[model samples]
Target: MYRLSGVVKRYRRGRATIDALAGVDLTIEDGDQLVIKGPTGGGKSTLLQMLGGLDRPTSGTVELDGTDLARLSEAKLTRVRAATVGFVFQNFNLIPTLNAQENVEAALVPLGTRAAERRRRAAEALESVGLAERRAHLPSELSGGQQQRVAIARALVKQPKVLLADEPTGNLDENMRDEIVGLLEKMWREHGLTYVVVTHDTAIARRASRVATIRKGHVKVAEN
Candidate 1:
């Protein structure tokens, strides 16, 4: 579903330039569950942004489903992002003011979904994530695990083919982390979704179909 070749992403840090990704070459097949493990300052998150079309590579190609993202217009890229990808963040990124259902429905707004359909899809998404009963609850009223579930529902409510999760379990306890991992695996199986997860959690990496460790803007399989 994704192919990247000699991709480089550099940033101008005042007088110095920093290379976040240096000639990254990667391929992710449909239904591949990939975990990217790397130390701080490595390019794991930047790689995810490239794969999900959230950021353009400074040079080389990032192609998704045969289309080159680097060549797309910003409006075109926004359309592709809304249509093909879902994102889950470590911080949960939910609206504290909105209830769980509302938060999920907000993801559909960009797609211009009808209000009735949005509500229905949001409800179903929450149910799929096992948070249907908590739909009316505010973020502050829920546990950490429940809040993450709400975030997952929001991501999936778009029915994206690829899920880009950035440390989805980072804020949870061990048990909660396990729960989230199980939920992600189950979702991957049930939905035939491709997962690209950036995580420092070794347990999460172990559960992935493949693991790549990034260091100093390069990536390598941990094993030969």
Candidate 2:
């Protein structure tokens, strides 16, 4: 579902230019589960951003479903991100003031989903993540695992075609990490999502059908 060709992302740091992604070429098929592993400062997250349309490449193309994201106008790109991509991050990225349910509903706001429908979908999404009972809880009131579940719920509430997770289990303990990873896998299967995760955990990498190791803006893929 994703075709990235000659993708290059460069950032200027003072007088020197840094290449976060240097002429990378990758393909991610529909309903595929991929895990990206790399050290810090590698191009893993930058590549994820390209896939999610959160950032544009300095050169080359990032195509999703035949449309090049790099070529879209900002308005069209925003609509694509709202309607097609879902994101989960290492830190739960929840608003402390919003309750679990509200956090999930916030995702639908960008799509202009009406309030009543948003509530229904958010409720179902939370239920799917096993957070139905904690709907009223604030991020500060929930455990780390529970907070991450809320984040996952928020990401999936819109029923996006692709799920992009960056370091999703990084902050959790071993047991919690397993639980979260299992939850992600379950969601991927049930939702038929094209899942791409960036993680450092070898255990998570071992579970994937394909693993990609990226370093110094270069990427190498291997079958698990």
lDDT of each residue in 1-224, candidate 2, tens digit only: 89999999999999999999999999999999999999999989999999999999999999999999999999999999999999999998999999999999999999999999999999999999999999999999999999999999999999999999999999999999999999999999999999999998899999999999999999999999
**Model 1 ranges off by over 4 Å:** 222-224
Q: What is the lDDT of residue 199 in candidate 1?
A: 96
RMSD of each: 1.3, 0.7
Evaluated with TM-score, which candidate comes out highest?
2
lDDT at position 197, candidate 2: 99
Off by over 4 Å in 2: none
Clashing pairs in 1: none
Candidates' lDDT values, in order?
Answer: 0.92, 0.96
Q: Work out how many backbone clashes candidate 2 has.
A: 0
